[model samples]
Target: MPVFADVDTGVDDAMALVYLLASSDANLVGIASTGGNVDVDQVCRNNLGLLELCGATAIPVSRGADQPLSAAMRTAEDTHGPAGLGYAELPLHQRELTGYDSAEAWVRAAHAMPGELIGLVTGPLTNLALAVRDEPNLPSLLRRLVIMGGSFDYRGNTTPVSEWNISVDPEAAAEVFDAWGRAADAKVIQQHQLPIVCGLNLTENIMLTPTLLSRLAAASGATTTAMSVLDSRGTRSTADNTLIRTLEDAMRFYFEFHFDQGEGFLAHLHDPLAAAVALDPSLVQTRAATVDVELTGTLTRGMTIADWSHRWGRESNAHVGVGVDPAAFFDRFIERVGPFARRLQADR
Candidate 1:
């Protein structure tokens, strides 16, 4: 299956990229960059650098939306670190970026693949919204859209009522959700499967535990069986010696953020979980809902209002992720990418 990723190149985004590269099923066609974690330029660079680090540079990279459709840009530098990769730094990409911008990349890739492209979007919906505006028939073209945004069950991460990705560009999210829910022409009502949303409600459950980290932090030189967790492991200090140190460095800030949130040395692996669910829909248990974004509200602006009841008489446009198998997801990630993990103590 052809998989397309739209990312902000945050720490978790990098993890998703690597996971996709390592996956046996991922025929990754291209990656489109958008502004959220840092900016579109840095997102492109980060995407390229990760592809290079994973030895998957053959994948094309496209730079997209420097800002939201109609809102001022906000970045997660504090959460993702200054460079967006946390502590790890990657070699500057030698290959030139793809000519198509983010919007163009989404449109072109979808058209080329027709109804076979499975998209995982892990950032603000700026690029997607722009693509929809350019190609009104975009919703009907994609095989599936799995978005890592919104917060329906609990409090939001950014605001009292909004999650970071959706809060950053609610208008764009609104357009994307509405597009999938209803066709471009009002007379033509399409019953599209609601985009699967791995929102805060579902993502908060996939926390990074010490055991998971220890398994992933094993030296690439270590001999192991398939999906085997090394009986003996290196200390946290020596974890930087692993090839996946780049991800380790990035998680420093994430760990700290989680600590501040009273989560205790654990960071919710949000984007990667979205990517996992996208590639394998069975990874998450979902409930269909008529989902929409709040573009104008005094306190609930950017909030994703999901009507679970049939009172709205609206078609369900989003499959709200309600449950996930954390262990299965983590195991799959390690099994696919662990072989490529090596020792690298470099922070920069």
Candidate 2:
């Protein structure tokens, strides 16, 4: 079983958690919330509520940094809504309080594990930066870190040059990259690879297809009904109707913000693709290259510069995902979620 540590602050991040729960392969050890799309407190609250909705109350939830290390804090409230949950008005569910401080807790958990654990990050790398600094051996303890941030050649959602996660805290991201580079230098990890980066270039290749939508709808109905019955709740709020509701809301916001100004009906699942990559690397096309984060370029602060030229003679420090097989990815996604869908129906 693999333990996953996620630092999330977006509605899509919540949907990613639901996907992880539905997948039997991911042994979710804990979740750490950070302030990116919303305040730190709200992110923590949303994490608990989402875990409860998915019936994953046993999983520990922790709170992380409230702001960036050195940069002015910024958020995507317009895209994720005021609460970072698509503006869906629903009462917060009561749950047990988190037991540890987020940053320190993450460091402790990583060290306590027998071996390196899978790290999944969907927000700014602030918490990770702090963890590496606090625990000198933290980077070595990570089996792998799959980050859903940055853009290689595609258009960015934040600015013309930067992605939201990286833009939120470029300084922190820089530190993380540097730390990982040092760890890779110390040991020759498997496959002669550095950090595996699932940037926008690959995630954009995965779009919401009609078939995928239909499967999601079916699963949504069954899960909603099962949850309602199990909880003894007579009625399900329209806002809390199904897990797909969160996905739908995220797609709506993403499309409006990026492609159609809110008129488009669907958007690609960027974060989910990152999660899928963590589960199986063969699903994507990866190339090892020396990658650097631009922290001073006025128009490209958060941009990841991959030295593909090989002209500069820089050693490759990261594995950059360049492409993906969309058809195969869709098949795997549906295949994994199908069992969960069937289980939901059978339970009903």
- What is the lDDT of every predicted structure here? 0.81, 0.70
For residues 1-348, write the lDDT of model 1, one tens digit per residue: 899899999988998887787777888899999989897788888988887777677989998877898999999888887878877778766988987798999999999987788888999999999998999888878888899999986899999989999999999999998898776235343433358999999998889865576677553443323211232221123343444556666766677667767877768999999988888999999998888899889899999988998678977787898988888988888777676565222322
Provide the global lDDT of candidate 1 against the true structure.
Answer: 0.81
Best by TM-score: 1
User: Model 1: which residue pairs collide?
Assistant: 194-317, 241-343, 242-342, 243-342, 243-343
Once superposed on the true structure, which residue ranges of model 1 sit more than 4 Å away at CA? 184-193, 219-242, 342-348
Output the TM-score of candidate 1.
0.90
Q: What is residue 41's positional error in candidate 1, in angstroms?
A: 1.4
RMSD of each: 4.7, 5.4
